[model samples]
Target: MAAGAAPVTTESDCRCDVMAVTDRDCAGVTACPGDRGLLLVAPGGYRGRVRDPNLTRSAAGQLSPERRATDLRRLRTERFDVLIIGGGVTGAGAALDAASRGLKVALVEARDYAAGTSSRSSKLIHGGLRYLEQLEFHLVHEALTERGLLATRLAPHLVRPVPILVPLPAGESLRDLPARAFRRAYYGAGVATYDAFAGVFGGGRGMPLHRHLSREGARRIFPSLRADALAGAIRYYDGQVDDARLVVTLARTAASLGATVVTSTRAVGLIRQAREVTGVRVRDLEAAPGSPDAEFEVHARVVIGATGVWSDDMSRMLNDVGLRPGIRVRASKGVHLVVPRSAITGETGLILRTASSVLFVIPWGGHWIIGTTDTDWRLDRSHPAASARDIQYLLDQVNTVLDRPLTTADIEGVYAGLRPLLAGEADSTSKLSREHAVFEPMLGLLLVAGGKYTTYRVMASDVVDRAARRLGGVRPSRTADLPLLGADGYAAMWRDRADLARRHGVPVGVVEHLLERYGTLTRELLALIDADPLQASPLAGAPEYLAAEVTYAARAEGALHLEDVLTRRTRISFETTHRGLESAGHTAELMGAVLGWDAATREREVAHYRARVEAERESQLMPDDATADAARLGAPDVRGFAADRGVDGDSVELPTSSR
Candidate 1:
């Protein structure tokens, strides 16, 4: 390994020529990569051609289709020091950590990156405040430390502080005065302790201290709050992010550090040499079942499973390979609904304590995210369905404080994700502690599961540290201080955003949006637009996203299907009033151009996405989890294998029933 030189991806083979951002440091900064004419890089850098038509130059962290193809070849032939399954936050983090430590690492995901629980989180990066009530001080402290790191250092561009209010309800009469005083004292003390923990841990909270406001003051800040709802409110700050975007950034960061990151690839069976795991037999979900290239074995010194709820399924794979699983994971469903920001006339987000758990009303761009219910889920883990009852429960809970009650018509989007809680004896899923566990049941396999999103980097560090112990001579983790792909020199980039917008002939507001979504990587999109100025035009249906963004997702963000682009890469699926139906065809077209899809393939992609939206709508109408799950399954998966792994097909099918 050499300083300022790209890490070679595979052993004894120059499969890819991954050039670091720039050959020379520019004015002692990483943001300006030498006039920004990137040389596209990949596993097999390039074929016989001087330049690739699809990809322009060698850019570190770009997961172009060519890179995936080359990486797949490497996965089938090369040996790695560490192999990580699951492309969620933790798995991606692990890959980055291991790769930066100078180890050969490969990561495979069953679906798109952040396709499961990682993308559907409440979008908050905070130490669990309620955990303080549970006397889980260590957990809170650890999580707070990580939060500070993400907000201030690790991913300052992506993670930002958001103000939240805890409304103090007014008493009905003098008889209830004691309850009011008690509520204020208890909550105030808990919040003060939370601040103290943050102040003592890491560097600091990285946001303003909590503030107590009078009833009139709170009402003035939140005009839509019912006059009789609260006596006052306590406002504090927590970090928030586009969860799916964060995961994508992590994967890109891992790739930039020489980790082989692939999605739409699943672990089907464990490759074992009698009681010891040697590698994994993986199924390329993108490949047709039973095809010659459908499945391949990836060899590694140590194998780790970071699958969340899918942790139990890894146990099944172990059973097939004559190994017993050591980790037990329970799935808890969390549902969130998105509505226009105008639905709630509030300047700050709200946190409400419910009978069983806490609920958050988070402020998204031009939208409000209200959620979530904590209940055990036994149905489909891949597509956890949110039922009508669940939606009603959230509405009822939030309506207690809002001047105007919300209805189904107010919802623009709904999503449900499963939380992997470490199996415990607690009767309710809400009672289960948000703690993670790691296991090495077999000689070469490591299993890490069950933790809150806030501590993903910590979890990644722990799992990799264990794996390093098995593979001697590995270096310590370097992720705590290391920034993600777009993090370094972000402040300078943001400071010159106006000049950047002017140089690119784009609006300052547009530049601001790109900076928030992509820090220094915004240059990539600007480059794409420069190549084809037409791509600068916003989508007809979803004006918030430029056409270039869709192409960028396909070319550099590892988006294989239409749903991946709509739902995760850009979030147009949930942000739009039509739930992305109005934008599906155009999105597919833009993605098709990069993915090399013909007319028929593009049509199929559009059809599949539309059917998925409808199925989600129908499922939301269902009264119970079972019915909702069944309704949601009516739409076949864009990745055929995601619907049912046993299904025999290579095509991302669009059935007439769903259409």
Candidate 2:
């Protein structure tokens, strides 16, 4: 056994090797590192089959344990058209775009898909309305266009319009009328412009137009508004999504289009051939440190780095190869708090202006998603910390207009995300440019940085286009009108949800839940429930989810770890009061059934999730950033993913983020 070789066990007569050449689970395109024959066994005993007994694949967009191993073997031998270095939305988008255009593609993430800023986004898809004030019209228009595609043409099942209210300031007396009217005019114009941009941009038709609401009228819709806090309100529409799910769908869609996607594999360094950048040197983070498969080199004609907050790290890879790097990316921190819907008696999401930035009180299922503070972050990017001060600041701002002010006790969960803003002379992170830029430090390497979540498709297209131009004979991006994994038959399925539930012998509510999460793919879950009636039972700790959903995530959604199941695959970590602790053991058992985790491994998974929750809780209690970040260090990240993995202010787990 040698380094960068696949693990093999000698048999009585022959040797088996992992290899990849087709969409099938176990086959090889090339010779094994040492073995004479390729007998690729999909990880976790796949035996050349998809876990779904009833479904078939034209290479289905399924990311499971089996595909992960098959793809890893492909990384060792296949020379790809493009290799993307991040698994966030942008990287996943690039993979989908390139692969759809019939180019060979491979993507590697040090952590799970969307394990960084992509999962921690504000979860909105709109042209940043505030950016209209900054006159970044082009950026806003571009984002609005992408928003339309995501909500309407692309991922209608995941991205949908949410009604948002812009609370207008009400004057205390006649003396303040002039200022109040002027303020109303300003916000009204902004909302109007936002709508106008959407309509003109193509995606705006999915949502209703902006409407002015009187104080009395606004209160009728949102009864929790403090009477004196606002005179009138302007209601507008913006899109929202399950950000992490979007990334996973993008990765899966890429795989369906013949891309090799693998997670927990970190891009340790660049693979250079003299003056030409060739590929990347990667380490399998999930592999045992001294194992043969721990480290490998992936050859790509061109490499696209969508590392976001970790963009500076791309520069360091250049320096490691004795080249001066030229990408400048800075990080902006945004913290969000989740509380029960009962805590905030609002039907429509609220957008309140702060001294520096706007705050959103978005409505989620049975909960209110409130956020976020925009400030510069210089600590631990893997686990950006939000202090007591950050939490207090948000409560203070939203309390000014709430009939009953929320307290720390009202908070159910807290998550802090970092935005990769383009470095500039702007005085604050909020003022920095949201526009993304692309740079090539060498002939074959491209670094893409500094874009908002809404415009990820555009950012991906630009970078991959650059790679395509260099590589030649590539088709233009086909993603603009392409529907994601479950979007195709979603509307029809939603229309028949009641029948779907009745036919599956479950409640309509259950069918609705699955439709929203998995779209037309809900059939797969229904099949699971049909096969195992017990699969229909709701998670005892979090009834919002079903046992079958966890099984599906493990079997088809590439959930290799517990955090992948609870935190990203589902929002149980933040949506549940127990922060997923009560459900951790149950989820681990469910995933273990698919990934072959033993009792000890299941216990380790539960303990890791428990420690992570406690660490985040303690970090939030701290009064300032330094103390908050230090407190987060109390728990080690799962799979040796320390906040800083062997570098000063550098993390192997690259992140992408923001508003």
Candidate 3:
């Protein structure tokens, strides 16, 4: 593996080029000397011809309709050692871990990967500083260790340390000087402890401990704060990551390690004989919209239910034993609102204590991600639309500290997600535990429920470690030390990023963005540009992303549907001004070519995606959950792709019921 070189194609003798063909161009196909001997064809679109990873030249991209069919056929024929049920961070982590450990692995998600709570998180990969306040030393230590790994060793490209300022209230309380000193001394000790634990993974020298600022200094740093509110603040560092990209990369890494990763595949039932669980009954979601009916069972040696909120549903499939005792999965709704960066101008993020919980105004791509109301949610789990109350809660909290208040109009995007808290019989959902639980709820069914986003890897490693024992032949989990696909030499890559950007004729900012998301794999994306110079151009509607990424997502990253490409594969839904409506058609057009969709299919994808946006808007308009669910139902299936899988070929003429 030479630096700046491309991946070699599979041998022609054993490999087949998986490029699709349109009726428009048939003469473009050419057999090339590479790993997969099948002829590659030039793909049409904004980018230059997709590059052959092995050949390094712009060869036709594989993922043609015919190749997709063959790939599906091969997937159906194969048996994986471990079948992971969710495509959240935990499940994705399990897939990567299992594959790296030499186990045959397959990960199935009913929706796009990380389409649930994973993408809708606070976007920080930090050790919970609040946990330290609660005296959960062990949890803090463990999280700090993972955070260090993510920042330095594992995903330095994706995760970087962000500084946060926690402002103390203005006052004439006890000795101001001593209290500031005490707070700094106390919090500093905790950060130092975190740093010490971080050293075990790789030193956390880059992450600084807490430092106290004077009232004047605090005001200088965050001018929006009420100057009279007069106390100082403490600043500390924590790693932030694009949660969606982490999961996407994890899935890709698993695939690179030989895991069968499928999106839009629903696990309808648990395949079982007598009391023991075996495989799963899955329906292919990528089929035509109207088609439905049959479900096929995918048999596997072990099943891991990393379904999170839907864990109960997976548990019920295997009878009462499948559900663990005292396993109360409560849904706590956390909503975030994206506002323009101009709303809060500061070098660092602001964290203040609200009456209910802490408020975070974190910075994202050219915008501020202000969030999170932790309230009870007894609504539809799938599409947790942000309610008026959810939005109001955030606005009120953010408005409390800002000089210029923000209204509903300032909101660029609003999203709501359910946090699977370990349910307790408390009157309030917030009182439930964020700590996760893994249970052998039933024979052959392993369920992981109730965890936060930061600890997904630990949860995943634990679940896979357990499943390994059941499968008989097991290898120790290697994900702890394993860098994801794009992680190798990322630091060095970052150093040479400017030169690479110049060579590729892309902006330095674009190169930085690519490095942040893909790490060393930026080279892979760059190869797409290298073969055909046109690929270097940014997407027409969504300039934030290069056009080649959309292609790379489908071919290399396993995006099965349009929504997978827009929503999870890229943060187009939340990051864009129109929630991806303007870009949906273009994206669909790009992906539909690869996915084998005709013009009609392309239209359907765009129409369905637009309806989904409209429905989400309508849902947010409703007063409550019931009304929201009804209004949301008015929209088309955004996940219609998942509904199409496993339809029977034979239309069995069953005897009509004679009443």
Candidate 4:
């Protein structure tokens, strides 16, 4: 094959041609054999349809079966300037930041990218308004700056300004009126300061500042709020992003800049010598028959641990000889409820203050996402289930202002996640600070924890900066100006989306969705659907996503399992009415074919998911963390991970935490 030409349509294709694209999985897109009758995928993008020409079939970090046989392969066979564990935003950002600066980088995640807290967020890319109350001005300012960067320069397609209204009760005390005014002024000042701060950091000036609204004005903007409930309100502008897409874009950007990223691969053991850490031992969880069972070890000079909640384990494994670093992580469980948008008929979202912290009723694609109760969590860090009590707590809080209350029947989905905080014993986890802490625990081991979603880039940059000294003076962080894949030239893509939609026979809205999720890379998914237009139809039960997205996730993004596709990649688990239970089988079937799973394997996946939901339902019925943890343990592993996979279930490793 020619240098820039696409690779052959078989597994035994030329290695050099495959290397032309970064080692990311391009499965169906680049690997499938297409019908050969002059199928023009995209007029100027790709010429032929023998395969998807977007390099979607090349799986990263999966160079060859031989290269993947042992752990520490990079440490012994080759050297990487930086080795990043955890494929969440922090790790993805680290890879992008390091590789963009001419550092040889490799990032590995025990699960799929963003499988942890990254994918399970409330999906807002906003400056923390609550931080202003805590007087964390610097953190708020930094977050606002990043929000602007993502909205305009970095990922305009993914991040957009969402209008949020904070209501004030009508029958409040005279003193309460003054207090609300004071809060408005303080919040306004902070927002102005944020706007000015963005100017200094070279961020965009597109979004407006915070505005105070009268009772009538507030009612006009948000009709769902009871007319008598509000004395006045405040309207603020913030960024909202597809959290999973952001993580994938970061990983793609890193791969584009020459970093090797792999998913469905686990870091089972750390490769180390006396008093110094070197690399990792990884095993492919879905290996084919006759595949070697031993771990693959990759050597690297510096290993920065970006594994958020798993930081303690990574740190402990790195240092078996020296005094271990203090375990400073506290896991807080946050639960969210998804209801149909008809429940709240309004334009702007509501951010209601509650005794527990705050309740956000945000609009998400024809649905209202009301959530987030923060409490102590002591079990099941991987899949924090939403129990009956958690659901009731959210419903009771949200019912305070709603004209008509919501019940279980109105619920489309419920989800829970564990947030990693600096270890503390506060009475309420909601009171914990959103600030981050980075520690160099021992030689070659950097552990980072205690940051919120908005500041993941800063957290990653700081971690890499600390480990840079060990890399013999690496370059300073340049992630601020760097745009993730699909971010660059997004504005132009948005302008031409209508034409692209017409050309591909897809709806204009579908084009918009694609641009929002993948920016210019939407063409890649469109091209795949163009080959087999049936794939272009949305998934049966979950109409929010196209069937092509599942294939794209497995091929382009590193989705190796059904759970990775349904839960993280497309949010089928949290967006559907049944929490994806009704759609799980079809999803498994589609994902199974792509991943090479037989009927037995598919049945196991379905059973595991069902048990998980049941366990979560049981856990939510409990009042406290201990009982919830115990109930949640009723379900076994959903992925049925092999013995060689990272975690061993000899004993349950539930996170014990306070506040």
Candidate 5:
């Protein structure tokens, strides 16, 4: 194969026979070679034509208001084979996995999808290099494999390769030369092992191999590095993603595969008959403030909990039935600070070793992300506030090698997320395992927790495999070859970006921005802009975002609240210095037009969003988690739904007419 050329596969290159035989043994299907793998057989065992993966393109996958309403109705009326709690990446992946395998699946989330840890990650789909030092080869391999898949086959639109530079300090003394050489050798060996694993297991290959650079070479690549701070640097590739977008894409993909995805609905308790768990009792948190809560039941053959940090809460709900969950979740909070890209002036991302955890100075669009502090957190899971101490710690660590130090004034945004590390004998949160564990505490109940973001698909597949044993006749997970909603024709769309920009009468940069965010779906956004040319203009306050995106968030994405659109969907909230307050009203107006919100309701949404931003600011100023949690909780939740930390029994019922 030539450089950058697509590979051609012939009949001999097909692994269908091997995959079909393996799937048959796992799924207990005795059908012959005719009825296996991607090739579907007729009723009489005659081999049918091969199915075209790209044949279907339906707007049914779009999470518009109509779809949400229809899905909610389906949730209340239908019984599914699998009921997945939490619409985070793991649950979304599980829904996709189960649904793609020809099983009925439904996923319900308490808040907006990816509102938790999924959206707040460092945005890297890296094979854990630190894990290799910990002798966790399996984890590194699994994460690398998933990373390759995301960057190439699965979500090429969302995931891309990011080159990182690890600096090595210059040796001044003659005595220090051997020590420096040893350090370099040690780091090089580890990185080589990392690359080897990626090469062997990574299915979709795109990234370049690791390279050693001289100090001058390193400085040439990253001129911002402080002089005399490094002897040289090692460059390596890892995958990066729009974490929140990946979650929503997963949910949308799952929805496209016939899974009913409902957000803004809380799972109050497990519906149990005698000793076996069967379904969930849920409450619509979108109920009018001061109105009675409307509750309903979603029955399923099996319930899978993928609620990340809130796993313990879900487990506690099952405890009421006298079924004690063996796995316990220990929450660890990780915080990241975002500054403008001009602050660093680096071509590649920097990976600096910190005393406690690794610091990543990642390059985002027009901004750089510097993070993170890993500490045990027992505060409110919903809002894990980052304190001044945490901010100072990150700044102090990153400043060690920066030519220009970043202060609080330089920060554009700050976000905090809690990792659901499964409790083990490890003393520190950093020492805890990233490997996930699945448990069946009851007959129809399943719980999956602990894994890192990179291995969510694997975790999802494992959980569904367990569920398949319970619900017989369900095929194995087919998500390995599945492309996310916007991934199928992304490469082609990217190649024709210039033409798209010319056709749409927008700048090439604008088209490129849309492509990076929406991939091939950029065409749909362009269509919206074409219908109303004004929609092509930048937002009133947040010029980085187009007005059309705000409307699209509500119309096509499942953004019920203004905060959802600003904060997660477009990232305007944290990306702006005003924390999206300036654009709040205008954005809300766009959303209101789609959601049919009255003027009063639009005003209220804007007010609520500003209050939320103020609360977040106040929380960041607090000294500790306790005070921060109190400050954050001071802001009213959009739907007035309080955290049901220890609630028991069925959800409180409101009038059915409230629906």
Candidate 6:
């Protein structure tokens, strides 16, 4: 398990005796029974052998502190073929695409991975059904194709099929029957076309086709729907994912393929020579104050600006150096509200039309995520605040069809994200296109902006295709055929869920949850549970996640701060009614042990997290964007604090030593 060491596995290393059932019949007490017994395949079927519990301890895929340091050293010393700015899904995907195609790649994120628009997405991996109404068949086809690939071939563990119900307004009387019929025909044709596109591009993979339901059937499926709200409903299948996890997984997958993925790093300036972009000037946001290497430069043959909403700022940086800008990005803010499952009794998700954008009542694990309002935002790009007006707007729209309206008290979490809409003459943000455009604004520089989360893979493929032309002899994108880290052997692992539960001495539900989140990578967590059974216990306040997950975030997921573990690594921050406050202390302590934080550092981490929750609460009470942004700024950024405080005795210094 040493750094760069190959995992040792043999044909006789099968551990089938650990579990007595297959994933199908195990009910949750068995392990996967592969052809060669209970031997699990490592990611990408590397070596085609059973994975050693210790193999994950190596430098290959483990995003440990040691790996981070190693990657940082490489970023400073080595010249890469492509250096990507931004660590959201698009950037991460681009890095994976470039690295897999045999290009030397390095990726830097100003904040944590998916800490921007990527994680704040609606969490759907479907073709934009509304786009069909806009007559955007090409966009729909591309998105559907990528959705199919994600659910079937790529990140199967993180992406799965979800059914959505669209309710039709009820008629006033028998005399209004013709109008109702017309409404049904109109909506029904649109849905039928959606299914047709999926059939053609989705490869007929995952989830059932669309189906029409009577009022009784709709009510039966969603008893909480208002009796007068709908005469009938349409049910269709789409895919959903843990958006944050997908971004992190993409980074990890790229790292495993030899790309340098560094978080807590900011790209401050573009390094140019003559008229060609050469590299990037980056600052380690986590570095101690006045540290010599805190701000350094990385050399690369080409640099890509994949920053989402900050795309314009990146373009401005090039303009500052006299490079002509080829693209402009308009920022649109979308906010979502998370409430407990008791708020709405629905077996399937609900999608409703609004004045501008569509609103979705998605069924999360133990909550319903209802959102969002699309409005132009000219406030803070880092933390877009969800104002009281934004929350009220959502509540009003969703309340129109719900039997029991939700109040502010029912809201567990509120989040706002800014979309990088490609700037056009369109007056409204909702009218902007989701289609992306890639441009080489300058020699050796590629800029990609404006694409939906569902079509990220396509966007990545397209950007890399353009980059590949500049770097001659580079291979074409192979990501279409490359399954993400946890995707390999997922079908077999699912079958052995029961056996895995039994092997780990946990409930079937816990195993199932782990399987969905980590896929075949669940074994790494199982190893932690085996080493210390205490790790298998549910989190102190949030029972939805295991305590080991918090530790794993630090040990293997490159989590450098408490917020990264609580908010992005797991959904504890938003899923819990306490907004992760009650669990903050315990979660920080767990991460502290793995990241080598002292007692003061641990306490500081907890304090900062509490302040963040409070700031969000205060922001939610504000009436407008300006006031909300001001309120949100009341909580100082933890990384910013680190940078400002430097290595002074008053502040706890971030540990530079490897864990």
**Which stretches of model 2 miss by more than 4 angstroms?**
1-59, 320-322, 645-659
lDDT of 2 by residue, 266-343 (tens): 877777788888988888877876899788899999988888888886777567557786678788999999999999
- TM-score for candidate 6, residues paired by index: 0.89
lDDT of 3: 0.70
For candidate 5, the TM-score is 0.90
Summarize candidate 4's per-residue lDDT along 1-659 as a digit string, tens digits: 23344545542231111112222333323233432111222222232322234433222322222222332244336667788888888888887787766567787776677877887778888777777767887877778777777787777878888888877666657767777677767656765665566556527754676687888898787776787777788787677777887887787777655566765566666666876778776665555545775347777888777777766666555344666664567778788898988888889888888876888888888888888978887666776767778889999998888778889888888777778887776777787778888887667766777787878888888888887788764667777776666666678889998899999999999999888777877887898889999778778788868888887776667666667777777877777766678777877777776667799988988888887777776776788766877787788754445212124764222121101
Model 1 stretches astray by more than 4 angstroms: 1-58, 288-290, 320-324, 642-659
Per-residue error for 92 in candidate 1, Å, reads 0.7
Off by over 4 Å in 6: 1-59, 641-659
lDDT of 1: 0.82
Q: Compare candidates 4 and 5 on TM-score and give the better one.
A: 5
Name the Cα RMSD for model 5.
7.7
The predictions' CA RMSDs to the true structure, in order, are: 6.0, 7.7, 9.2, 7.7, 7.7, 8.4
Residue 632 lDDT (model 6)? 90
In the range 379-442, model 1's lDDT, one tens digit per residue, is 8777889999999999999999999999989999999998989998999999997888889878
Candidate 6 lDDT by residue in tens digits, 1-659: 23333343553442111211112321212123333223343333222212133233122567889889989998999888888888889999998888777577899886788988888878899898999999999999998888888998888999999899989889899998998899888889998998888888885567678889999999999998998999999999899999999998988888766678898887767778988899888889889889999989999888888887766665665665677776688889999999999888989999999988799999888888998888999876777899999999999999999999889889998888888899999999999999898988789988888989988878888888888788776667778777788888889999999998998899989889998999988998989999999999889889889998998899989999888988899988888878899898889889988888999999999999999999999999999999999999888888773222113253222211000
TM-score of 3: 0.84
lDDT of 5 at 119: 88
Question: Which candidate model has the greater TM-score, 1 or 6?
Answer: 1
Per-residue lDDT for 331-436 in model 5, tens only? 8999999998888888899999887768999999889998888899987777788888888899999999988888999988999988889998988898999999
Write candidate 3's Cα lDDT for 152-192 as tens digits. Answer: 77778888888888776654666676875676667667666
